[model samples]
Target chain A: MVDDGGLDVVAPIGGAVRDLLRAAPGASVDLGAIDPRSTPGLPDEQLTGAERKGWARRQVELVGRDLARQQEMLFAGAKVDPDAGRRVLLVLQAMDCGGKDGTIKRVVGAMNPLGVHIRAFGPPTAEELRHHFLWRIRRALPPPGQLGVFNRSHYEDVLVPRVQERAPEHVWRPRYAEIDDFERELTAAGVVVVKVFLHISKVEQARRLLARLDDPTRHWKYHPSDVDARARWDDYQAAYADLLGRCGTDVAPWHVVPADRKWYRDWAVAHLLRETFDTLDLGYPPADFDIGRERERLLGTAGPLKVNRS
Target chain B: MVDDGGLDVVAPIGGAVRDLLRAAPGASVDLGAIDPRSTPGLPDEQLTGAERKGWARRQVELVGRDLARQQEMLFAGAKVDPDAGRRVLLVLQAMDCGGKDGTIKRVVGAMNPLGVHIRAFGPPTAEELRHHFLWRIRRALPPPGQLGVFNRSHYEDVLVPRVQERAPEHVWRPRYAEIDDFERELTAAGVVVVKVFLHISKVEQARRLLARLDDPTRHWKYHPSDVDARARWDDYQAAYADLLGRCGTDVAPWHVVPADRKWYRDWAVAHLLRETFDTLDLGYPPADFDIGRERERLLGTAGPLKVNRS
Candidate 1:
C-alpha cells in the first residue's frame, strides 16, 4: 500500500506531490493542453487498473491521518493562544460531474469533523443577492484553527454570470482582482487559501451524468439544469481558464487536478492538503502551566474533595 | 472483529444497543450506583485487556461505516425534499476527563465531515449571554439532513449554575421544565435528538487528569478550572442526576454510557448513533426527473457541444 513512509517519525515532509500539481504563477492556462486522465505523481505505467486505484486509496488514507494530526495541532495551538489567528480555507471549484463531492467524502472526510467546517455555496437567496458578491463567502471563512472547505465558492460569481450573460463584462471582470485582493487579505490574516480546480474531460462528465441518470439511487444527483450547464461546456472551460490564470498568486496558487480518475482525484487533493500542512511546521501547544507543580498537586489531591452545598 | 452483522442489507436494525443504554424517563438516576467501568452489552469478561480494547475499536469502526451510510441517505433524502426537515442532533455531555473528545474523534469523526456539523459549547460569550439560553443553541441546531453534534450543551446552564451556586434555586430550578419544553419543540420539528452522558468515576477522572499533567502534548487539554470542577464532582453528579431525570422525554431520551475505558466509550457512542439512525429508516430521495427521458437525453448528448461566446 502507498503509505506516507512514516513521515511523522522519519521521512521528510511533503514536496513532490505538490510540485507536480501546482499551476505556475503568471502562466496562461490552457485547459485543452492538460490530460484529465493523467496521473502526475504516481508510477501509473507499471500498475494494473485495480492496483493503481488501491494505491491511490491507500495514499489518500495515509495522507489523511497525517492531515488529522496536523489539524489537531492547529486546533490545540489555537486553544493555547486564541490570538494566533492561524487557519486553513480550502476552495474547491469544478464543473458539473467533476468529482468535488467525491473528493470531499474520500479525502476531507478523513479529518476529525470537530475541526472541519464545510459550506456548500449554491445559487444566492434573495437575502444573499442583495449583499456584495463576497458577503456570503466572507461569512463562511473558517475561524482560527479550523479547516474550512467551500464546495463551490465566490468563483461562481465570475463563472456563472459571465457564461450565462447574467452580468456585463465591467461587473464580473473586476471580480477577478477583487477576488485576488480578498484572497490576499485572507492570506495576510493567517488563512492559508488552498484553491483547486478539478479538471475533468467533457466525455468523462457525460459518462458520469449518464450513470447518474441510469441509477435510481443516484437520480437525486442529476437535474435538467445539468444538461443546460453541459451545453455551455466550452464557455465554462474558457471562464475557468481565465480565473485559473488571473487568480494564481504567490501565496495561493491554483492546482489543477486530473479528476477523470476518482481515486487519483481524491488522492491528489489529500496530498495537496498534506503538503500545505507540512509547510505550517505546526507543533502541539506547549504546556502553559508548571507541569511538575500540577503533577504533584494532581497526585496529592487523589482523595475526593467536597464542594459547599450552600 | 465486532461488525454490525450486515445491518444494512441482512439483519434487523437498532433496538438492542439502545434498549441496553437508555435512561428510563422520569426515573430517578443514581450516579454512584452505575458502574463507570462496565461494558454494558459487550462480553468483556471473556476477553483479556488488549483483546477487549481491540474488539471495541473494531466495533466502533464497523458501526461508524453504518452510520456513514445512514447519514448519506438522510442527506440525499433532504436534497430530494427540502421540506422533509429530517435531521439528527446528537448532544454529548460529559465531565472533564470523561472522554467526550475521545468519543468525537473516534466515532463521530468516522462520518463524512461534509454532513457532520459539530459545535462545542463552552461558557457563553457576552453576545450569547444577552439572549435567551436557548438562543445560541437554536442557531446552532443542525439544518435539514445534517448530523449536528453538540459537545457540552445547554445542560451546562443547569449543571454549572446549580453546583457553583451562581443562580438561586428558583432561578435555576425552572430550567429543567424549560429544557424539556425546548427539546419537545425540536422533536415536533423533525429532529431526532440523541442525548448521551458519559459516566466516569471520580477515581478514573483523577487518574486521567494526572495523566494530562504527566504529558506535555496533552497539557493543552487541561485547565486549572478542571481541577476546581473535579473538586465539586459530587455536586455535579447530583446536578446531572436531576437533569437526566427531568429532561428525558419519549421522543428524546438520554443514554448513560460507562466511560472509564476509552475504547468502549467510543464504541458505545458509535453504536448509539447507529441505533438512532436505524430508527430513521432513511432511503435515498426518489429521482424527481424522468429517469428514462434523462437517460436518453444523456446518451443523445454524447458529442462535444459548443457554447456561444458572444
Candidate 2:
C-alpha cells in the first residue's frame, strides 16, 4: 500500500489505488498494455454491467463527501495562515472524447465551488500567444487555500505541437525541462501538483464521438476535426508516451487513468484526489484571536432589534 | 403561482418560494415584519425541529439535482451560441454571520464548478480604491452560458460606505442610480440577475458567533472585531433597507431570505436558483456542425488501435 500522505483519517480506498495508478517516474507508458476496462484497485467480482456502474457511482459519491471536508480544511488552513502556501493544482490531460469534462463534473464538482478554481485552457488566444506559454498558467494558479483544476493544461503544449508538427523538435523538446522547473517552483511554494492523463483507446474515442453525433443534444461537443485527431492516434500515443516518460517527476507525478468505462474513470479520478488530499494531512486552523474574550464580547451584544412593523 | 417563465420541466418548487421571498420593486422594506423563523414556501407541518431540518436538507438536495441539469442546459445553450448572452448572476449580500458562505457551499456548490464563476467582494485594496467602484465587479461578470455568484457585491458600496461613514452621503447616495444603470446594462446584455439578502436575526447572529468561538476548530471564522460590526447592526440594517428598496427592480429583483435556520437558508437559495433558471427556459443548443457527415467520418475510422504490448 502506498503511504497515506499524512492524513489521519482512513482513506476511502487505501493508497493501493493511487500507487497502482501512479505512472512510475521516468518510466515509459505503453497505451496498449494498460487495459482501459481494468478496475485497478477494485476487487474482481461477479457483478453485472449495470451493477458495476452503480457500485462505482456510489463509491465516487462517498469519496466526494470526504473530499468536501478535506477541501474545507484546506481553505480554513489558508485563511488561518495567509502565508501557508498550501494549495493543490490538479492537471487533467486527455485526448479528444477521453472524458476530461465528465471527470471534472463528477470529481472536482464535488468540492465547494468557492474554493475551487477551474480554468479550461483551449488553444492559446492571440493575447496569450504573445506571452510565454506559462504566463497564462501562472496567472491561474490557486491561492493559498484553494483547489485549482486545469481541464487541459501546459502538457498540451508538448503533446499537441509534437504530433501536429506545429513546432520543431528543438522547440518542443526543451518544454519538458521548462515544465519541470516550473513545477519545482510551485512545489517549493507549497503547491501540490497532481497530473492525470486519461488513457482512452482509439476504439472508445470512436464510440464516444459516434454517441455524440447520434444524440442531437450532444452534437455541440462533437466537431468534424475530432476525426482528424483520431486519424493521428498512433502519432499522438507516441507523443504522449514520450511526455509521460520524460515529465513524470518526483515532485509532481502523472497518473494514467484507463478511460474505457466512464464509471470506473470517474471513481478513479475521485480516488486519486481523495488520496492527494489525505497526503496533505489537512486540519482546521486554530483561531488567531482570544476565543474566551470573543465569546464574552459576542454574548454581551443586544438581542434581535425591535424593528417598526410594516 | 407565478408564471413558469418558459421551462419545459416541472420546477422542484412552484413560483411561490421566489414570489413570496421577492422584495417588491420600489417598496420600502421593514426588517421587523419579516419573521426570520418563518418557512415561507413550505407547508405548515406537524413535524419536530429535527424533522423540519432533515426535510429541508433533502429538499435542497433534490433542488440541486434539477439545478445541475438546468445549469448544463444553460452551459450547452451558451456553447451553441457564444453570442447568446444568456447567463445567471446570483448576488448574495448579508450581515456578519449571515450564512453567505454556507449558502454558497450548500446551494451554489450543487452545480458543476466548470461553468460557475464566483467572486467574494471584500474591503477595497489600495489599487481597487483607485478605480470606479463598479470596475472590479464589471470585470467579474459571468460570460455566456455560466452561473456567476457574488458572495458580497456592488451593493457593499452602498451599505458599507453609508453605514460605516466611509464616504459622505453625496458620494454613496448617487451610487443607487449608477448601480441601477449598470444592472440595466447587464440585463440588456442577457444577464439574469438574482439578488438575495440573507436576513439573519441579531440573536441568531450572536448565537452563531458564540458557537464559532466555542468550537476550537471554528475559531478561524470568529473574529474579536466581529462584535464591532454587531454593535452597529441598526445602521447596517437601515443601509440594507435603503439599498433593497432602491435596487430591487424589474430587470433584477431582490429576494429576502430568512436565514435563521441554516437548512432552510440553503434550500431557499437553491430554490431561488432553480426558479431563476427555469424562468430562462434553458435548453441544450443544437449541434452547429453537420452531424450526419461527422457520424460517417467517425464510423469509418479504424477499430481499437493495435499497439505493441509492453
Candidate 3:
C-alpha cells in the first residue's frame, strides 16, 4: 500500500529525510544529541511493530525498484556517452558492529550487481600499507556508469589513527585536508560522493555482539577486537565526531543515519540513495541502431524458432 | 651499457623477445620442454654474473621508460578519445613462490602508479564466494587508458579447483569455456588481454621457500600451505598445461615466462609489456586548448612573481 506513489512523491520526501538526517558541517557533534532509536523518516504516528515493519519493507521495495531503474539509466548513459563521465560513490563509515554490512545489503544489494561495485576495506594488507592510504581506495573507485560503495572507506585513515593513537598528531591531522582534496578531485572527475555515518548507540553494539555470540551461525562474525574496540567506544565516538565536522564539505557532506532501528536505518538509506539518483536525472540513451528494421530482419531470418516451455 | 639504443631499438627487439619466450598454444606443455633458468631474451654470449645482471638491469630500465611513455599516451588518448576504449589487462598466474610479485615490482612498479592498477587476488572473501569467480575479477578490470595487472586471477578458479579437487569435474570443467567467453568479451570491449604464466621449476620454488624460512624478517611470507601446494606440483602443472592449451584464444593468448631466474623473469616481463604498448601504437594526444596564447598571457600578467627557493 505504501508503494502507491512509488518514487515520484518519495524523491522529494527523501530529500527532506536527508536534510533531517544530515550532520551539519563544522558543527560539534554530540552523540548524545541524536537519538539512534528514532525513525524520523517514518510517519509520526502510533503503530504496532508488525505494521511498522510492513511499512518499512514496502517503502524499501518501492525505493529499491526506483533506484534500480535509475541505476540502469545511469549505466546506459555511461555506455552511450563515455565522455559524459558521470558516476556515484557511496561511502559508508560506522563503528564496530554499527551496521555497515547491513546497510550495504539492504541499500545496495537491491541494485543490479553489474552496475554496483562494493569495496570493503579491512586492515591494510602489507602491499596496501606500502602506498599512501588513499592509493588502494583510488584503485577501488568505480568508473563511469557504476555505483561504487565503500563499506568502510578512506575515512578510516582519519578515524582509526586518531582514535588508536597509531600515528602522531602531525601525521593524522594533515589527513583532513588531504581527504578534502581527494573528494574535491573525485567530484571534479564526475564522481558524486554521498557519505553516510550509521549512528548506533553503544548499547545497541553490545547487544549485537552478544547476539552474534549467542547464535552459532553468527559466531564467525564475532571478533575479540570488537570488544576491545567497544572498550574505547567514547574515544571512537569523539574521533567520529571530529571526522564528521572536518571532512563534511559542500561536495560530500556526512549524513548521520539513526541505525539502532534496523528497519528505519534500511529505509533511511534507501531513501537517501533514491534522492541521490533523482538528482542525477539520468535517462536511457536513444537506440544507436534502427530497432524497427532490426526487428523486421530478425523476423525474416530463415530459422526454426526455439521456445522454452517450462 | 645495454641502454645504448634505449626504447627505440628495444621496442622492436621486445617483439622478437616475446616470440622467443611465448609458449606455443595447443602444444602439450612438458614443463621439462622449457628451461626455467635460461634467459632466452638476453644475448647468447657467455658473460660474468655481474655483467649479466648489469645488462639485464639496463634493458629493464630502457623498456620500463618506454612502457611508461606509452602508458602516458594511452591515458592521454583515453582523455581525448573516450570511446576509443583502448586498455590493457595483464593477467599474471604462477605457482607458489613463483616470481609474480617480483615481476610486478620490476615491470609495473617502474611505471606511474596512477596509470598502472594492480589487483592481487588472495583466497576469496566470504562475499566473493557468493558470486561467480569472475565477478571480483571483472570488477577489478581496467577502464579505458589504464593498464591493469592481476597478480593472480580467474585462472585460479580453474587451476585450484582442478588441482585440489575443490569442486566437482562438472563444475570446474565448464570454466574453461566460461573463461574463453569471458576473454572474448573483454577483447571485444577493447581490453587487450595478456595472460602470462610464470613457469618455475619445483626445485626453484623449494629454494625460494627455504630462503623465506631462513630469513627472520621474511617469516611472514612463509606458510605451511606453501609446502602443501608444492606437494601437488605435478597436478598443478597438468592444470596449467590444460588451461594454456584450452583458453589461449586468438584474442587472449598465454605466454609462459621462464621464471626460475628472478633477473630474467623481470627483464622478460618488462620486454613483454614494452611490446604490448608498442602494439597499441599510441601517441600523445594533441593539446585541445591554445597553449601558445596562454603562455603569452602568463608572461604579460603580474609583475615581480615570487619563486620559492625550497
Candidate 4:
C-alpha cells in the first residue's frame, strides 16, 4: 500500500504521490496487477464497508466546498489580470458502465455551473467526422476562467478504432505521439490538463449494467452493444494499457482511479480537483477602478452625477 | 406615452404599441423622425429628472427579476425535453457609445450566467476573414436553452463595408438578402432573434466620447478613430436605415430604441426581454427518473445493495 499522508490532506498532489498515481511514460502498464478495489491515500482500510462509505462521503463534501472556493478565486482573478489566460481541462476516460457520468455529477457538479462546462463526445456526426479529430475538441475548449470536462475525449479516436480493428496499427500508432504533442501545446498555452482513467473491474461493470437493467427509469441509458463491448473486455484493456503507457507525459500525466466503490471514486476525483486548483495559486485580481469613488457614485451620496449631454 | 399596464406587466410586446417601436419592413426608415429622447411605454414622463430616473430604476428592477425567472424556466425545460431546441439570439447593432455593453451588463447580466452567453465582436482576425462572414457568427450561436447576446454582430458586415467603400456596392448589397435568409433560417430552427438598434444623436455620442477621453481609467476604451467614425455619421445612419428597412422581416423585426437616457434604455430592453420569454411560454420539463426509488436507494434504507462477481 502506498503511503498517501491521509485522506484529509488538502495540499497539492506532488512528487512521489503524483508519480505513483501516474502510469509511467513509455513504461509497460500491467492492468491486472493494479487492483480496482484498492483506494490509494485512504487511511484505515480495516474499516467496515459502511464505515468506508461514510468516510468517503464526508471527504467529498469537504473537498467539494474547497473546489468551489478555488474556482471562484480563479474567475475573480481573470477579471482584473491582463495575463489571466489560465484554465483547466479535465478529461475523463473509462470503459462502458465505468461510472463516467456518476463521476461528473459528483465531482465537477460541485463547482459553479457558470465556470464549468461539460462536453460529452458520442459518435462523430458527419460534419464533425469531416474535420480532423482534434478540430471539434479544439472548438470545445473552455475559455479563460472556466473548467472544461470532456466525458470521452480525443482518446476515443485511438481506443474505439484500434479495438474494433477499424484502423491498422500504422494508422493509430502515431496518434499516441500526436496526443502527447497536443497536450504539451495545451499546457504551454496555460491550460492545465488533468486526465483521469476510472478503472473498474469487469465484474464491477457487469454489476453496474445489471443495476441499470433493474431500474426502469434508466432504460434510456441501456444499449444492446454494451454486451458486445464486454466480450472484448481484454482487447479494450490492452488498448487502454498501451495508451496509459505511451501517451502519459510529464506535463499531462494520467491518474488511474480505482472506481469499484462509487463513494471512494467521487472522493478521490474531488480531492485531485481541489489539489489541482490549490497548485494553481490563484488569487483575486487587483481592482481596476477607484473603488471609493465608484461606491459613493452608486450610493448617490457623492459629487455631481456625471452625465454627458449636448 | 403608451400604457404598459404598469412595471409588473409580463405580456408579449404586441399590436400597435410594438408597431410604433418597430422599423417596418420594406419601408424607408426616417432616422430624423424617430426622436432619440422618446420613451414609449413609460408612464408619467412629465416629471423632474430625478423622479423619472427613480421610476425607470424601479421598473428595470422589476422587469429584470421577471426576465431572470423566465430564463430559468427555459433552461429547466431543456433538461427533460429531448426536443427542446429553443434558444434566443439578441443581436445588438448601434454606433460607438450607443450603450451595448451597458445594456448587456444591466439586462442579461441579471440572468444566470449558465444560461446567458455574450459575444462581443471586434475586427475580424485573419482566420475569421478567410471564412464567410457568417461562418464565425454561426459557430458562436448559442445552443438550445441559451440566451446569446451578440454585441455588434453580423450587421457590421453591411454597415462598415458600405460606409468605408471597403467593398463595392455589388459586394455589400447582396449581403442584405443573405442576412434576411440567415435570420429566417434561424427562426425556423427555433431561435428567437431580438434585433435592437440603439439610436443616439451624434452630439450625444461626442459627449460620451469626450467623457471617455477625460477619464484616465477609461482611456483604454477610447480610440481616435471613433472621432473619424463620428465625422461620417450621416453615412452610417444611411447604411443603418437601409438595413432596418430591408432586413426587418415579419419573422425577425427590429426594435429602434431611443437610447439618449440610459435608465430608460435599460428599462425598455429589460421589458422587451421579459416579454420575449413570456411569448415563448416556457415551462419546466417533467422529471425523467423515479424520484421515490432513487431517493430510497441513496438513503441506504431499502433493498440489498446489488453487486456482481465473475
- The number of the candidate with the highest DockQ is 2
lDDT of 2: 0.83
Chain B TM-score for all candidates, comma-separated? 0.91, 0.92, 0.91, 0.90
Model with the higher TM-score, candidate 2 or 3: 2
Where model 1 places Cα greater than 4 Å from the true spot, the runs are: A1-15, A26-28, A45-50, A304-310, B1-15, B44-50, B304-310
Off by over 4 Å in 3: A1-15, A46-50, A296-310, B1-310
DockQ of 4: 0.06
Clashing pairs in 4: none
Question: Which model scores highest in TM-score?
Answer: 1
Candidate 2 per-residue C-alpha lDDT over A1-310 given as tens digits, one digit per residue, 9 for 90 to 100: 2222333333334445678888866646776788877777753344554566666677788788899989989999988787978999999998998999999888888888888999899889999989988999999898889999998999989988889999899988899999999999999999999999999877778877877888877877877889998899999998888888888998998899988888888888888888889899999888777767777677678555444221
lDDT of 1 by residue, A239-263 (tens): 9998898888888899999998888
Candidate 1's DockQ: 0.43
Residue A117 lDDT (model 4): 66
Q: Write the per-residue lDDT of candidate 4 for residues A69-110, one digit (tens) a residue.
A: 687677666544537578889999999888887787667656
What is each candidate's DockQ, to 2 decimals? 0.43, 0.52, 0.01, 0.06
lDDT for each of the candidates?
0.83, 0.83, 0.76, 0.76
Candidate 1, residue A128: CA error in Å? 0.3
Off by over 4 Å in 2: A1-15, A45-52, A302-310, B1-15, B45-51, B302-310
In model 4, which regions exceed 4 Å deviation?
A: A1-135, A142-181, A192-310, B1-20, B45-48, B51-62, B76-84, B124-135, B215-217, B287-310
What's the C-alpha lDDT at position B146 in model 4?
79
What's the chain B TM-score of candidate 3? 0.91
| Candidate that beats the other on TM-score, 1 or 2, i.e. the better one | 1
